[model samples]
Target: MVKRLTKHGNSLALVIDRGVLDLLEIDADTPLSMTTDGKCLIVTPVRDPERQKQFRAALEEGHRKYGKMLKRLAD
Candidate 1:
């Protein structure tokens, strides 16, 4: 879908469609991090640092607890 940037005082803004918003599970107030990879523009939701840390810790704990079962299943 094509989008046009609208003037927002000094900056420009793109109006995100509702489908995109729902798919991304983001709202107008959600913070997003943007970057470019020399060719394409990349936009992603910014995970809260504290929440991310908690998630990583939980994932590590789960891996440790389930590693044996998972390894057995894989064999």
Candidate 2:
């Protein structure tokens, strides 16, 4: 769906829909990070660094344990 930016003071803001906010579990208090690939904007919740480290560790362990079996299954 296309959305038009709303005038906020001298700048513009994209008002997020309540349903979309609820689906993403984003509230006013939740921190968000915005980035762009020069053409499109991407908005996402800021994830915890420690949680990310834990996830990477778990993924490494899973790959170490199942890499061979998974590769065989894929082929």
Alpha-carbon TM-score of each model against the true structure: 0.63, 0.84
Report the lDDT of model 2 for residue 6: 95
The weakest ten consecutive residues by lDDT in model 1 span 40-49
Clashes of each: 0, 0
lDDT of 1 by residue, 21-42 (tens): 9999999899999999999779
After superposing candidate 1 on the true structure, give the runs of residues whose Cα lies further than 4 Å from its correct spot: 59-75
lDDT of 1: 0.94
Candidate 1 clashes between residue pairs 3 or more apart in a chain or in different chains: none
lDDT top scorer:
2
Residue 43, model 2: lDDT of 99
